[model samples]
Target chain A: MTEKNCREEIIFAGFGGQGVILLGKLMATAAMKAGYEVTYIPSYGAEVRGGTANCSVIIDNEPIASPLVTEPDTLIVMNQASFDKFVPKIKPRGLLVMNTSLIETPPDRDDIEVMGVAADEIAHQLKSPRSANMIALGVYLKKRGLLTPQQVAESLPYVLAKRHHDMLDVNTRALMHGG
Target chain B: MSEKILITGNEALAEAAIRAGLEAYFGYPITPQNEITEYMARRMPEEGRVFVQSESELAAINMVFGGAATGKRVMTSSSSPGISLMQEGISYLSGAELPAVVVNIMRGGPGLGNIAPSQSDYFQATRGGGHGDYRTIVLAPSTVQEMADLMFPAFDLADLYRIVVMVLGDGVLGQMMEPVLLEKKQTHRKLPAKDWALTGCAGRSQNIVKSLDLVVPRLEKRNLMLQEKYRRIEENEVMCEGHLLEDAEIVLVAYGIASRVVRTVVSRARKEQIKAGWIRPVTLWPFPSRQIAAAAERARLFLTVELSYGQMFDDVRIAVAGKAPVHFTGRAGGAIPTVEAVLDEVKKLMQPGKVAVER
Candidate 1:
């Protein structure tokens, strides 16, 4: 029973079709596989019908207090809408990773470190557009350096549905590319 | 099946019921808890058990009443409004002395409240919301794992007392996902057989299973017996988690999702050397009154935080009995009380000669 001290709050935001919830689940799954206490919560309401979809993932060495993330330590945005929505909520000196392929502009924040990646472009090259979420996740894993890309890739079989098993290779490749 | 998996609280709780040897599950679709019904629908049939998506909450709970009469593990889950609809059936279950697990994944209330997490039903749940001279065992889980973990004990306790055990949670607990180790399927406590069940009276005089005793004195006796059973449960099954209570002057009292937030507030208060501690009621009914009264002997003040408009405040006040001042801070209608807001209340009370205890 180690004292719960280290906690990282993250928000993954994107449009409804952008695999935002899956990305949060992947991070949460990887963290759980690494034996850290984790909680993943999607924005639950009418917003999930089609508009903006987002989720909060918290990884901590100890039990999490509140699963909701008010101020995220890391904000990963896949599109322009999410980028504009979640950028202001990042903690000072936090990490912001944006999908440059869809997000035409970067966050105008001086307090946080920003990483712009052509995540959708890379996924398109990999012939798996859905793996773009994996690309942004990989960037966070590589930059945040909390959990490795290999860890998240290894968790793919567990997080993804069985029908999507065919995309594991592309998702893995996308992760490595972002890393 | 034994390995830990990252899953939502509702999903984990549903699987846990399967692991707990659930014989039947009845539910209607409601936000924040529809996952349980969906999961149970697929898994229950797969497990060769009974699952029903009843036409409504009223139908679901009556289904539970029917299922529980024959002496098998039965359950139904719903959100706030749906649970309200099930109240009559729940009261019937209590009067009939049938063991049934009813889960209330609460949401903002008053009426048709939005699908956001809320503890507004604290009063409804702990008070045995339905009717009649009765109280149900209410278990409040603050984490996803706790949601799963408590399901086993919930069934065991329900049968042990022949009462309805309510697993009370809010939208937050139902929607969030966490890593949970699937246990209880491999471990089970041997419980007493349901001899009073309506399985059959084939070999003897037909055993009547009914809550209605038309005779006034017979009904009075049954009510008194139920009260005795409730007393015994209160004596034996009061479950609470006490943190930093020893030598603490300020005590925070909460349960369910609110308790999770209070934990952080307690930690923050402790870091500031305010001697703050917390009491989280795992069993909301069997209200942990004795434990609270024990803490009231030394604590300078008690602050009850809740998601409702201080429904639990009355309980805390009763337990404290004015030995220490009891105050309340809460929000309603999907507004979650943050750690900072609760910590602010703690600091206000810690000020010298500034404690104005709200009666």
Candidate 2:
């Protein structure tokens, strides 16, 4: 991480109510804490409710340019709509992490690596379905080996609102469960 | 304060303004900039400051005008359509010589443009956007970090000059989240006392802050004084950044979010052995003409990239002054100019006789 000027472009996408934004924010905060230059750009246009929600997170060793990412190096999709829309935009030989419980259709590309995590199922076992995004986030971080699940777990208190801190225990458990 | 925090550009600028001793915050709802007002609404009251979500953009600017006269730091923010509504008030702020901050997190324009980021406000911001012999100082921030970094000075420059200072950013710069050290400025301009401020006369003569002057001769003298201030600002307040410019043949010129992409273009072009550089105007009012003019002496060609169709391009052309060919590549209506588009333009201009500077 210190030697190479690595730039990873990841897009996390799901339905609006899926908390995909908080998922990206956790990754961004953890990456920032680990001393990487990062940017998290969320696209919430006029129709923010019940629409397809997406955020682009770029973590790099060097200062990032063009916060907008046209083609992502990694794609994390929670629902089938996101998978259908963003699966084509992933760079060749890139990685795809999708929530397998909801997405029945497999990816069309063979060049990219795909991993399906039962994020919703894992999160439901902990009685916190809302933390499904966290579980999916943990899977990506665990596979990447660059940042740890603990890094994101620790960032929860800082990122989540004070009123929502009660869910910390369940969210952390889901993150570790996915790992 | 030196520790970095991941924050959105809109919140960062609002926080920066709050840390800059902003006494009053006034705003109305608009996208790409809602975060600034939202953050201020949440935090300003907690910090024991004044925060007003005014009735409208007009009301917000009038609130700024009223707050500015009291010799305290005040600010208002809006997007393109809302900002257009506040132009008459902005002109009044300029005419009254009020030291206040205005943030325009611009979006696509000409009518109710989309909420997606656009630099179409370049002309509106730089040209003062209102009828009068006045121009507000405009600072264009290229990144979220710059959004914070420029806020401190935006207020400082406003107070130092007794003029309206606009923090001009597009929706991308406003909405994007990045790591930034939102720190307070330690030093400031050794400003003269606010004797002209309408702080209510106690031991001295009453100070009146207004744009109204019925007497023709007095109005002319006041206008002349304002023009003199503008001249001083041009001489002393012009700020710009040059990148890889030494001995470069092709100059890339942009401001705000457009410059962020153009920077990527220039750096990528460098890898391909293109002698490209960038002239980014941090202060757009004092349009960095001197810097662009200097680049023209050595560069064979110049390209002005923007979100609008050559708003800043006109300024770059004027600055180049026929010393070199100035070309433009841009998009309008919420469309952002990408890195590839700009590189293609650069390569096209690099060819022999695509166009040449007019003698």
Candidate 3:
């Protein structure tokens, strides 16, 4: 794990409505709650819903400078297109976490760490495909060690809508299952 | 110390305004800035404050004008196109010498541009986007924390100068979430007694709050008065931050989101043994000319990084006054310049043979 004060920039990219933005927000909120300066910027455009949507999240001990991540330290890709688009942009020796259910072929990058989780499969096992993002995030938190699973779970109430509160247990289970 | 909360810039601004005792909020929904209006709509009514979703930006700015004329802390927010629609009312507010805060979460420009972030509205914001010989105090906040913190000072400065104060930001700043410490509710020390406000004359002489001074001489006098107030604000209200400039050979000038990118560039440049510094303008209308000039005295080069195609570059050139070379690198229509690009520009400027002073 990197020392405190070092910046970690991550990109959570997928097709829209895959909870990419929500996952980024959740990670940012958890990092902030753990006393790290954090920034989360969502990719916004006319084609936001069904198009390729990605968000950049940066967490550091010092104040963050830029919210846009050009070469992220970690890339969490939930779809094949997101994997193909963002895989090449990850820093050498960075972490690449992909949803294996959607991305069958692994990236050919030997310089970085790769973690493949069947996030959608796990979410389906949990009877909620929408919880796939949580599963991927669980793998990210477990691998990166930048944030604790406890911190991410504690932040669920803040990021999730109030009406979805009943699904906190399911999401938590999905997160733990993937981790 | 207050607990740090994760929030977007628009949400922070709305929360800050509520804490600042915002009396009324009148705004139309616009992308990138719609969150501000939404947050206000949800919170303002609960506070028993006035929040009106005007049918159009024109109506919203006019509502702001009416609210501010009554001596209440009022605000309106919108993106580029919507802000353009409100310019006339802004000019009226300025001409009437009414204090108001307007937040422009700038998006891509020209006409009906995309919802991505851009600083193309720099000229419109700093140069009195509306017609008239009046200036609005502009504060460009780069961080979500500043987005919250500056609202209090923005309202105070607007009230103090009796001018429209703009909190100019971009869509990136508006949409990005960050940790911010919400300042405790403030009690202003000396709020000006708005004696000029038209609160209806019970026994005193009737007060009129009108921007129309049709007579040429009176209009000329009013313009001069407004100029004097602007001059005073220019003298007292210029705010900027200098980072790692004590022994810098090059200084990067930027504001809002661009400045945030410059910080990273400066740090990276320093790692490569380049003496790069940055001057971030917190208040844009006052322009921070003196700080840039002071930096020019020592730094061999000045680079202006913006989200516009050289809009603020003109100001940088004017401020440098040819004492040192002034260079520009930017992207318009919502493209954010990357750290590598800015660092490359810095390295190019640092080359011994590449330095050329702008005439």
- Output per-candidate TM-scores for chain A, rounded to 2 decimals: 0.93, 0.95, 0.94
Lowest-sum lDDT 10-residue window in model 1 chain B:
B182-191
Report lDDT (Cα) of residue B205, candidate 1.
70
- Tens-digit lDDT track for model 2 on A1-179? 57696889999999998988888898899989998999998885664657899999999999887777888999999999889999999999999999998999899899999999998888888789888898888888888877878878999998888999999998888878754
List the candidates ranked by lDDT, beginning with the highest: 3, 1, 2
Per-residue lDDT tens digits for candidate 3, residues B184-216, read 545464767789887889999988898998799
lDDT of 2 by residue, B1-359 (tens): 57888889999998889988899999999997999999999999999999999999999999999999988899999999999999999999999999999999888888887899888888888888999999999999888888988888888889889999999998888888898887786546786687888776889987888899999999999999999999999999899999999979998888888887888999888898889999889999988899999988899888888898888888988888988878888898988877888888787777665566431
Report the alpha-carbon TM-score of model 3 versus the true structure: 0.96
> Candidate 1 — which residues are off by over 4 angstroms?
A1-5, B185-190
Off by over 4 Å in 3: A1-5, A45-49, B185-189, B357-359
Question: TM-score per candidate, in order?
Answer: 0.96, 0.96, 0.96
* Candidate 1 C-alpha lDDT tens digits along B182-240: 77643256688888888778896766677888999989999999999999999989999
Worst 10 residues of 2 chain A by lDDT: A42-51
Candidate 1 local distance difference test against the native? 0.89
By summed lDDT, the worst window of 10 consecutive residues in model 2 chain B runs over B350-359
Compared with the true structure, all predictions reach lDDT values of 0.89, 0.88, 0.90
